[model samples]
Target: MSAVTDNLGLFFGGYLRSLSICLWALVGSLVLGVLVAACRVSPVPPLRAFGAFWVTTFRNTPLSVVLFFCAFGLPELGINRSFFFFGVLGLVLYTSAFVCEAVRSGINSVSAGQAEAARSIGLNFSQGLRYVVLPQALRTVVPPLGSVIIAMFKNSAVVGAFGVGGDLWSTGQTLTSARGLETLPVFVGIAFFYLMITLPAGAILQIVERKVAIAR
Candidate 1:
């Protein structure tokens, strides 16, 4: 009991810190994903090429490699890490690549008639997207996007490798090493911590989807 109490602070703090990083990663990825999706859908060939290239590059590369490059490799080029910004940046960019594909598929699921109708109403491309296409497309994509968010949350745990302190996975490693507890228990704790976040978020998304469906 004393052992658990002693480590509770570390466990909770690490979870919170990791959650923070995950939240930033979620927002950053969503933004970048939307931009990439827009580029992929744009009429401009160059924009589509750029988006495709980015998606393929990040998708092919392991995320840990991306983190390593940002955390370790960048300093070689005089880029410095200040408070794990590089780790967050890498996670965001890497996760965004996948999220982009999710969102692009979502946008594609929306009927082309929506765009045409908006254009008939005098909306420009951006305006049509903002008012008509994105809203409907977002509704269609909620379930998949929710999965992406959950996945990103889980993946953010990897930032611990970059020496970013105070993440659940890193804390688990520290506790396991110091306490020499059974590996199973430590991993169980880590898995439970992740489930606590992801399960509820997924449920919420489902609820939203149901509501959207009912409204339609």
Candidate 2:
């Protein structure tokens, strides 16, 4: 507590950085996830195959490996960028696979009659998905998407370990290792900051789920 109190600015700074990582990853993953999910459910065989490949490759890989590749591997190909960019990229790439699956399952939960009806109305595949199917699918997937986001937020901590400075975990390390603070208090502070994000997130998700439940 004293460690956190003494370094309030550092702790809060770390919290903001971590929050930024999660927020950016959330948007990126959601957009990418929906696209991948669309590909998974598309009538075209190649699109489905590509979607399956994407889900299989990314879902099977560890987050650490993904981040390592973005952090180190990408640089080797002469695509150097800030650690923050790479960190968010890794998070989005990894999380989007799970998000895709969640969304795909939601799409599948939709009645076959729905698509047939869309065709009955002369709507093309993409048009049906855009106007009719996807809207319903997104509503159904809200709860699972919330869980995916929470997992992504936790994973953002690992990004800090890979030299993305000013995140909570990195701040903890700096405090205990560099500033001679006790590890317990430093990490306790970090945990508190994490909960600050997660608890409200969980509550908000619960509300969203309830709002969508009957409609879904």
Of candidate 1, the 10-residue stretch with the lowest lDDT total is: 1-10
Report the Cα lDDT for candidate 2: 0.93
lDDT of 1 by residue, 1-216 (tens): 444456778778887888889888888999999999888888789999999999999999999999988888888999886547988999998999888998888789898999999999999887887889888888778778888888888888788777887788788878778768667667777777778778877888889989988876
Q: In model 2, which range of ten residues has the least summed lDDT?
A: 207-216
Highest TM-score model number: 2
TM-score per model over all chains: 0.91, 0.97
Tell me the alpha-carbon RMSD of every candidate: 1.9, 1.0
Full-model lDDT for every candidate: 0.84, 0.93
| Steric clash pairs (candidate 2) | none
**Best prediction by lDDT:** 2
Point out where model 1 deviates above 4 Å: 1-5, 179-182
